[model samples]
Target: MAKFISFAISILFFVSTASAAPKSDLWERWDLSNEASDVQVSHAQWSIFLSKYAAYVDPATNTRLVDYSAVSHKDHRVLKAYISMLTDIDPLSLNKAEQFAYWVNLYNAATVDLILDNYPVKSITKLGGFFSFGPWNEEIVEVSGEAITLNDIEHRILRPIWKDKRIHYAVNCASIGCPNLYVEAFQSSKLESQLESATRTFINSDKAVQFINGKLILSEIYNWYAVDFGDEKSLIQHLLNYYEGPLYQQLQSYSGEIEYQYDWKLNEKK
Candidate 1:
């Protein structure tokens, strides 16, 4: 009876954690994009919001924290307006780069709005209900008359459409362990460099990779999205692409077990 109870608990734990990471199933509607189109989506309002609220809390780690509690009523309305503007735009008419930037900014703006609506909470996971891990599954916005959840923007739209592992770095979950929310909105003109910078900043941070007493520890983002990164060896290679300096050398020499962890605490300014 004891052994059976232990096994059942293990299975329950696996299910809970695994279910939190939705698989990258393609949403065919979002697959439509014009590669040759020159239209650009304006993220000016979002850029203004980010500039006012997001800041680098830790220079050494590049931890860009958001001031959720500091958001004014007027600024909150501006955020909603920004999201509404994005919803009104036809992403299919824009080029692939524009669409990418559009989705990323929309996802981030909506996430911040969600947190503000439920401020004074200790963590994002606290708002999503008893069985829910976080608000990712909640339908927070509607684009082109279709209601969309955070998971849809990430797993269904961004991940499947781009197939770039860096997509993981671009989307923020409003958590300390996740990549910093860009201080400026992602622009189509600088999307490549922005993604590259986000990836490099994250991989070098202790939140993403840490070597403690000879053991290699990584973020749960890597473990949850392992398929996006490929097998264990492939994962290391992917990390190497962004990792630099002495940490780069440490990773090269270390052939050991990798452990993964994540903190769901809100990435709020102190």
Candidate 2:
């Protein structure tokens, strides 16, 4: 009986870990957009909030951390208001660039708002009840009369619609292992440049790639959303696109096994 129980526990653990990385499935409703429309959604409130709270802790790694403990009650309300404003906007009315910026900013702003609401926690994975891994699956907002979760915004809308690998860098999970949350809100006019910058910043950082003991260590993001990055060879090619200097040469020469690691600690300011 004891042996069987242990076996069953191991199987359960495998199932849970396998299912933790949500697949990139389309939600359909968010697929709608106006390519010709010039409608713009304002992210000024989110920008202001980021400016006040977000800071670079390590210049070498470009790790941007948020001051959750320092957020005043008034600023918290402002952050909430920013999310509310995003929820109220009709995403279908905007052009492709605007829509891209909208979803990325919304995902990021909502994530920050969630952390602030549940501040003092060691990690984001601690919230959303016992059966939950994190708040990603929780219905945190409503858009176009349908409830939305962080998972939906990312997997359903952003990934399916944009099909840009850089989307991973733009949508933060409020964790140290995740890509750095930009200190500024994404704007439509600067969306391409922002995405490019984010991709470059993360790819070059140790969080994305590291060479340890002559082996390749990559962020778990690559493994979780492997489809977005393609096979191992393709992934290396992708990395090479952003890597630079000695690291770039090392990546080109290395042909060993790839290992993945992630840190789920809250990316809070010290």
Q: How high is the CA lDDT of each candidate model?
A: 0.88, 0.88
Q: lDDT, candidate 1, residue 201? A: 85
lDDT of 2: 0.88
Question: What's the true lDDT of residue 110 in model 2?
Answer: 89
TM-score of 2: 0.93
Q: Write the per-residue lDDT of candidate 2 for residues 165-257, one digit (tens) a residue.
A: 999999999998889998799999998899889999899889899989989999999999999999998999999998874778889877889
lDDT of 1 at 66: 89
Residue-wise lDDT of candidate 1 within 162-202, one digit each (tens)? 99999988899888888989878999999999999999989
User: Ten-residue segment with the worst summed lDDT in candidate 2?
Assistant: 55-64
Stretches > 4 Å off in candidate 2: 1-15, 59-61
